[model samples]
Target: MVPHQCLGSVWSRRNRPGNEHVAPTVRATIAQFNVVASCIITTCLGDPSMTAQDRAVVVGHWIRVAKACQILGNYSSLRAILEALQSVSIHCLQRTWDNVSRKSF
Candidate 1:
């Protein structure tokens, strides 16, 4: 999935084939999961072995989680997403944008 648009797509996919438990408790669990997931992604992005494309993939996953939490109607989760997004380096955002800007596939 595309980096910037990853979340919306993930949410849409989840809406179609979601776990029954994943939906109802999603609102309640989203905030904590978002933070944990964001931290993990942030750490992954910082791995010295990861390439630019790999970093972009990690950022895309964070975007997906953010989108999912937002669509779940969890305000705390949304806040966490905002914080995570801020924590993401500007270079990462630019890389995501660059990836998007050049897509012809």
Candidate 2:
């Protein structure tokens, strides 16, 4: 089965009637999504020790990973990664963003 279809099936199962409690699979999926997003944001901004250039490199790496996710039809991951990159903390890093290559934009 396609990746999205598999995820959709798992997600749909969670919303079915009489499923009073959340399924473990669904919960795990949600957690994984949140983790991916959080990790991206943290990697970009969590370390005060990282230089602007270093942060820019990390941002570029995540962007490339997001593009790969898009190509693989993993919209859930792509959305999470994009949202992280656009989060307030990461978005406000002017120096880091300036260090990012124009080609990356």
Candidate 3:
């Protein structure tokens, strides 16, 4: 998602109660799960062309997003993000994961 558009839209939706411009809670949860899963698969395994260093960078970005979700009290997104991080596909990349700092785990 584009940074300004997605975040700006979510912020705007927070002000209006009746308008259905955004997704409902369940749909949002499913969407978040799908997004995180896609990120995990693509970043960790899908791109044979992408360097391990590049994938690690993408994973780090997701970790930051997860932390932001936690701080915002968005547990569903946080849970989905965490599950993506914990997936076996990501874990299978030992070299990529080794680049992650010990404190991050």
Candidate 4:
């Protein structure tokens, strides 16, 4: 038998009826994270005139999104967004980040 079928059979045996809701919740959470990740990367990379303050604001917004992902138990999205933020940091204006509050970091 195929591995997929084997796994499904095992999963079905252990699964409860009401747990069917998990798939849709997971799908929606992933979709939301995808959009958020796209927006964060685009906003940071596309704008050359972005000030340090601007960068801090962007990072702050992403931090909030990451927190939401954590609360929702969506590790995939949280990791993706955090990585994207780290990737974009190399391009960020240093002086602006210095001025930002520590809590945002």
Each model's TM-score, in the order given? 0.47, 0.74, 0.62, 0.56
Residues 3-92, candidate 3: write the lDDT tens digits. 443565565774477756454553465677788677666666677887778778777777887888899998877887788778887878
Pick by lDDT: 1 or 4, better one: 4
All candidates: CA RMSD (Å): 13.5, 4.6, 9.5, 8.6
lDDT tens digits, residue span 1-105, model 2? 235534665557666787535456557667888999999998888888999999999999999999999999999899999999998989998999999988877
Rank by lDDT, highest first.
2, 3, 4, 1
Model 1 ranges off by over 4 Å: 1-41, 88-93, 100-105
C-alpha lDDT of residue 19 in model 1: 41
Tens digits of per-residue lDDT for model 1, 1-105: 234333554445444554433334444456575766467546655577776567666656656766777788876765765666566563455655455323211
lDDT of 4 by residue, 1-105 (tens): 234434555546435776654445444655776786777788765688887778777777778888998999978788878877766554455775576668866
**lDDT (Cα atoms) of all candidates against the true structure:** 0.56, 0.85, 0.72, 0.69
**Which candidate wins on TM-score?**
2
Where is model 3 poorest over a 10-residue stretch in terms of lDDT?
1-10
Model 3 TM-score, all chains together: 0.62
In candidate 4, stretches whose alpha carbon ends up further than 4 angstroms from where it belongs are 1-38, 88-93
